[model samples]
Target: MTTAKNDINKRIQELTKALETKSARLNDISNTVIDETGKGHMVISTEAHADYQKTLGEAREIKSLIEEQKAHLDIERFPRRAERAQLCGPGRRPDRARQAVQVPV
Candidate 1:
């Protein structure tokens, strides 16, 4: 369980870093300007705009992956009570003292 938790955390970190890089690239692309000769106005090219959109999409995907990793980490850190009970087997309780009680007839 510890190893699994560690792996999930590592994956989340990796995804977060990737998202950051993609965001940075998107910002750079958005700020890019194309110089059109004889026209004093700075404008972005179609290709640069497309690149920004693609990077933005990638960043969104990475953000989703990070969220999934966080969910996995949460599960690993705090397993559901029902799952723990299941591990005790059928007709068995988690508390041994409760299991030792005798029913009065």
Candidate 2:
């Protein structure tokens, strides 16, 4: 279970990094270009536009995956937390030894 949680955390980090990279690329693509005349123009070729859209879509997908991983991590923690609570709840004595019953002949 710890391994699984680690894997999920790694996946979330990977997805988050991918999403950030895609978003940065999208920002670069959308940035206005300054021409020699000091004029700023947002000129995006159809191919570039398409690429931007594709990258945006991929970023959204990665975001969704990150959310899923987070939810999964939460779920993974819930059982451990519940078990701990059950063991250490009020009036609970986990360290106590059970008494043995004596049998009458």
Candidate 3:
């Protein structure tokens, strides 16, 4: 579990860094001036805009992947009640863990 969690974290970090780089590049492209037809007209980088869109899509995918990893971790951390009882409820018998505890009443 720890290994899997660490792997997921590492992937998330890499994806985040890649996304940041793409965003910065997109911003730079957006700021660039492509062609100056006249004082009233100017064109920015079309290729940059396209790259930005692609990057944005990739970022969204990364975000979703991160969320999925987190959800999986949570599920692992907190299992079903019966499963828990089976693991630590009774004397050595895990199958009998779900049985109700006896009382004097």
Candidate 4:
């Protein structure tokens, strides 16, 4: 039973790692698309443009898969409930991790 649990944990970790990697790759591809679109000259060869579009499509698909996997993991980890932010209001932002709001009387 313990071995099975450990295996499950390992699989989860692997999935998490893959999701992170794919997310980063997706970001890179998106940035590339943005950069290419920003270029003033539309001088890219037809073949190159086609390749870029293909890469962009693949990146989008991979990103979707990563998100699906992430959602599945979230459900596995928090089966009964979603995150506080998801279930409630805006909730805490990481940028304001330790800051507290002050109120005056």
Per-model lDDT: 0.78, 0.78, 0.68, 0.56
| Best by the TM-score measure | 2
lDDT of 2 at 87: 59
TM-score of each: 0.64, 0.69, 0.51, 0.42
How far out, in Å, is residue 18 in model 3? Answer: 2.2
Q: Taking the tens digit of each residue's C-alpha lDDT, what string does model 3 give over 1-105?
A: 578767867776776787677667667766775558767586756776677677678767777776787777666566654576666565555555445444465
Superior candidate under lDDT, 1 versus 3: 1
Better TM-score candidate (2, 4): 2
Error of 3 at 55 (Å): 2.0
What is the C-alpha RMSD, rounded to one decimal, of candidate 1?
7.1
- TM-score of candidate 4 against the unseen true structure: 0.42
| Model 4 CA deviation exceeding 4 Å by range | 1-39, 80-105
Instruction: List the lowest-lDDT window of 10 residues for candidate 4.
Output: 80-89
Give the residue spans of candidate 2 off by over 4 A. 32-43, 88-105
Tens-place lDDT digits, model 1, residues 44-96: 88899889888888898999888888877776767655665666666777676
Task: List the candidate numbers ranked by lDDT, top first.
Answer: 1, 2, 3, 4
